[model samples]
Target: MLRITDARTGDPVTATPARRGLTRVEARVERPDATGLRVLLTADVLVRALEIGGTPVWTVLTGTEDRAELRARARALGIRPFEDERDGGPGPGLGEAQVLRVCARTDEPAGGLCVEVAPADIENGVALDDGSATALRLALLARPRGTELRLDAADLADAEKQLKHWRGAVAGWATRPSGPIPDPVRDQLRAAWEDDLDVPAVLGVLRKVETSGTVPDGARFETYAYADRLLGLELTRDIGRGTPA
Candidate 1:
């Protein structure tokens, strides 16, 4: 339940995941210089987002406080944060600060792999879309304590195919009637689908509920998990199938 408020407006702004670690991540919004707004991070441990009651709840990351790691991550995105007192320390104060996370961004690459999207669920894995129509799934399984990605690259292709013919045959059973899932959630899911975002994974989860004879509850966090899984799975298959690079 971390909140990212607007530094200039003091409003509740959407705070995307910077990077999830277990060390001490002293996130601060350094003063915007001629370049732009400089965000700083001081952490050592990064973990996956925990979904509780359908909410992405990040854990309390406290470790050696690897400021370098966080700084490097920001740099990759073309965001430069002063490592030492080089460009002067962080701004007077952080305009925004909450439970820092390793939010996946589909717009760019992170680490070495280009994840499909950030982690929306703690149960699902991030994805790798190799510039193709397909994708691969990599579970972000942890030791039940953190949000670190727990799966290896080799295992991504082993996930069960979500779009198989047999799988679609059971859509009726898994499909939600209409009102079961809230409107806001439905809108969110709909928006994602329209953009070809994370449709299959979420719809797949709902279908699972139908197969189990349980109604699909469009829980906020669950929706996120479904979307993430679908996005990751798509890329997993894409990469696994060896689609042209």
Candidate 2:
């Protein structure tokens, strides 16, 4: 059962589908800019989590102008393509009413949910070009949704360093035979993501797993691969590239 904080009611609600088999979800962006990238990525995470929980999701992206550029950025960040993409309907950008209209026009059930992400407060003179897109994604996921993301160069650097370290570590761990994810760690991971997509908590769990002497290397490899299903960080990319020194 996926539980998310209801943006409308401020209460935790089960993401139940109106229809038996499909849950309709729409992610709205006011513009196809850096802030929109955050919103798109968040929605992608939500979709992945839902699918992991055995829910068939129909996802739509609204208010995108440059489809080509948006798709490129999303691909670079490991976001799956949306099933449907369209511009916003008649209204003042992507306000609540506009979101509802977009959903309605697409035959989304009344139970369908719209995820409206808040804009990130990026520092002046900070360019996303400074770091890898995957690292930028990790940096963004480190922060909670609805809060203004004060992204800076240091955050990007830390994210890049963490990604590099994890990939290299995973490469080394992959030399051993695969094992199951430890039960406690699996539960912790599920709890974090199930509780309103608490990705930072999930990352904390990974940090502990990385350093714990009790976990076998093979188990560590499995644990990271499982978590990467949700993280989309491509942590195993370094595997077969030679282990870290």
Question: In the order shown, what is each candidate's alpha-carbon RMSD?
Answer: 14.4, 5.9
TM-score per prediction, in order, is: 0.29, 0.84
lDDT of 2 by residue, 1-245 (tens): 66776555557767653323565556665556668788788888887777788777666777667777887778888888875555544322331311221121222323334444556756677666524888989988988766666787888889899899999999999999988899999999999998878888899999999999898999999999999999899999988986573
How much lDDT does candidate 1 score?
A: 0.29
In model 1, the runs with Cα more than 4 Å from the true position are 2-94, 99-138, 141-154, 160-177, 182-210, 216-245
Q: Which pairs in model 2 have colliding backbones?
A: none
lDDT of 1 by residue, 1-245 (tens): 22332323435433333322211123232222101111111111111111211233222211114545544444432232333422212222233223332222222221211112222221244343332112122222111111223343344443333323223333322343333444555554445333312334345444454354333432432443344332332221222232222
Candidate 1 TM-score to native: 0.29
Give the lowest summed-lDDT range of ten residues in model 1.
Answer: 34-43
Error of 1 at 122 (Å): 20
Per-residue error for 172 in candidate 1, Å, reads: 6.0
Estimate every model's Cα lDDT from 0 to 1.
0.29, 0.73
